[model samples]
Target: MEVVALVSGGKDSCMSMLEWGNDTMGTDELDSFMFQTVGHTVLQSYAQCMGLPLFRHTIRGKALNQDLHYAKTQEDEVESLYVLLKEVKKRFPNVQGVASGAILSDYQRFRVENVCERLGLVSLAYLWQRDQKELLQEMTEVPIDAVLIKVAALGLDPYKHLGKSITALRPLLFRLSDEYGCHPCGEGGEYETLTLDCPLFRYKIVLDETEVVIHSDDQFAQVGYFQIAKHHLEPKADYDASLVSGGEGIVYDVWKELPDELPQCTEAEVAVDAASTTHGELQAAEPLDISLSHGAQAKCRGGEHRRVAAGPTLCRHKG
Candidate 1:
């Protein structure tokens, strides 16, 4: 079961795939209501660093319908995923599901699940509903090199914390969680992260210079964005990808509480790739007009971005 991973160049998205230990075959189309466009300009570097092809689709719709249960509508953001996945499926026919890093967003989960169901793809939400502290522990334990790019919390200072790795901010995060009721895992939009290097990365992204753009300078909550100005990819020594975090990829059937539309996936047949284009009505939909796209494909070569290491919490549905 090859899966098309949905990456936003963030920690959870990176970690979600890490949890499954699957190599992402592709990624990114900047700017959408559903995805983080910040640091999106460098998203292709992820695919490049991992030696995988990158697919893209410009989002042309807004979050028109915010219902807990998603139903497609014309000019809606959810439809963009539907179309993008359809195109991915068209390109990579072996893809069986999508990998997401969603931990607490039912809004996001429903929309993604909706798209997967329509296209016969499984929603591999490995981090769904997991304990936040544990998730953070696992991310840092596996040690994803990630930094805060955006901060919007009462205790967090974006200018001070921007470009700082999450590992370095753990104590502060825990302190803030106790003092200000902040989300330790940032599930509450307190901040957003960009993974500079992870097990999935073939090379590490190094920042030479940066410009911090302040969105809000409030006393309680200061919102700032890191406009990464100078960066380059530096090659790293190869190591065993599977042993990075002892994570195996998530499969659809491994989930207990799942919708009936999702197929019964087997470990023997579950893996993640990028791209899904099987929406019946979306088949003829016009392609989004965007130039931030790439289509080169690469097979995993040991150290290449490839294969999943399933985590410890796999649950199977009773047949």
Candidate 2:
């Protein structure tokens, strides 16, 4: 049976892909699917590296405001996922099943299942209810090169997250889970991730460029902001997760934080060309150090201006 896995370049999604090769479903066959979001380049690149036939469904982050405020109610989730499923149906006309990397969030699972029921797309939760600790261990064992992209939890700071390697983050996540009740793999939305290089990827994603943007909230003490970056894939020279750990990316802060609607970036101008050479090697690269901004750009330590038009302004910050 042709299937599409809702990949996020996280442990669960990678596990789902690896599971496809195993003869668990006997005669049932497998295919791959990915849900693309603007900030999730690592996962998208991972899918390309793996040579998976991917169908991307775009969802505006702002559209999730209602769900975020209302706790992802059934109606909210169903409506959102319905849009995604409809797009998937158009691409894979005969898709028999839709796989997810869902682990413990019943809210997330229920929503996906509802979409599948509506579209006649079987819902497969391969990583549901498994031991959280064990799952983290497996992620390390498989050694997926994932990095934390956003952090909204107590124990995790933007510094702890932005450019840290997944393996480095694991022990801290484990400690957070043990002490502060944080979800081990951030299932509770404490954080989110992006996979750069994984076993399933055909080529490693190399991040060539980046910029920082703020998404602040009045209600929260620590406002939310993220580093946006561009990635490209290239053939693997030698498979080593640690080699790519150094290029984990950068972080910047929000100044004069307000609760206004976050601004969007100018659309990425680069096109994906299969023949593109590795733009920058990931081996032994350094994490980007950027200062907070009050107006249009973030000041980077390297003396280069990282532009952020109407997104975040650097005004008085010095580079």
Candidate 3:
């Protein structure tokens, strides 16, 4: 099915797209309650890199209702998604689904699924409720080439850490997770990443200019973000072309810098007690037909007999 990708210029979202493994008809760049919009200035380049059409919209609604199950309202931000997706469906009639990068946030997952239901589209989230540390390691190994664009956690130096690549910062991130109780995958908003390149890209995104804007200067934890002033896509040769075939022709001699012993990643998901909201009692998401088998990837087959219900069931795993 031709699904529309929901990109937010972040690592998890990009990885989710990679996990999609389907033909993405296009991409929608949104600034909403669920999106990390700090690097939205360079988001347009993502379409160029992925060779897809770009659809963009600024959310015009506020978080008037903060609940687990969302009801349709004109004044809420989820409605803005509804509006944008409605336009997408109107323009691309064959588009059957919407893809998102929801990890642990039940609030975001339910809201997006709510909009998909209203629009009669499937909601695809390949990275829901995965262990944070394992997810982080997989992201780094995926070689997403993501960088820190925002840092708002303790023990992270805003001035010193901003704009550093995730591959280079993995050690520090894990250490901080052990000592400072930081979320290794940035699930708790300790930091945010902006993906620069991925295997799916036809070109590489390069940051030409940027400026760090500090939101807070507290001694312990500093809140900061970067404004991407200018960026351009570097043309990359297609590996299927005459110059290369069957593999990436570019070679790297990595034995010199490689460590002989593989490091064991024991980082687990940080547990946070979620209390009932005073706003209202929450409703649990409808149980999905998909399996949550450990160390196994559950795929949704395209058989006519296999139909994923269009509600708050968000997990669509890899092969």
The best candidate in terms of lDDT: 3
- Give me the overall lDDT of model 1: 0.61
Winner on lDDT between 1 and 3 is 3
User: Residue-wise lDDT of candidate 1 within 1-319, one digit each (tens)?
Assistant: 4656688788888877665544444444333334565666567566556655556545555556756678878767566667667766775787766777778777677777888878987677767787888778778888799998777777777668988888999889988988988778887777778899887766789888888877656666766777777789997787455433222221111112222222221222100100121110111122222111122222223332322232222221211
Error of 2 at 114 (Å): 1.0
Model 2 TM-score, 2 decimals? 0.60
State the lDDT of candidate 2 residue by residue for 1-319, as single tens digits.
4555665555566665455432111111111111223244444343335443333332212223222112333322134345544544564465566666767655445555656777877676656776888878887777777776555566666644665667888889999899988778766655656667766554776666755333333243222324566678787877553222222122211212322222322233221111121211011011111111011111122332232221111111121
TM-score of every candidate relative to the true structure: 0.75, 0.60, 0.77
Estimate every model's Cα lDDT from 0 to 1. 0.61, 0.46, 0.62
Which digits, one per residue and each the tens of the lDDT, describe model 3 over residues 1-319? 6677677778987788767653445455454344456776677666556655565544544556776668886566566567667766776677777778878777777887888888898888777777888888898887688999877778777689989988889999999999988778787777778898877677778989998887667677877777789988897774222211122212111222223222211222111111122321111121101100001112344422222334444445444
RMSD to the true structure for each prediction, in A, is: 12.1, 18.4, 14.1
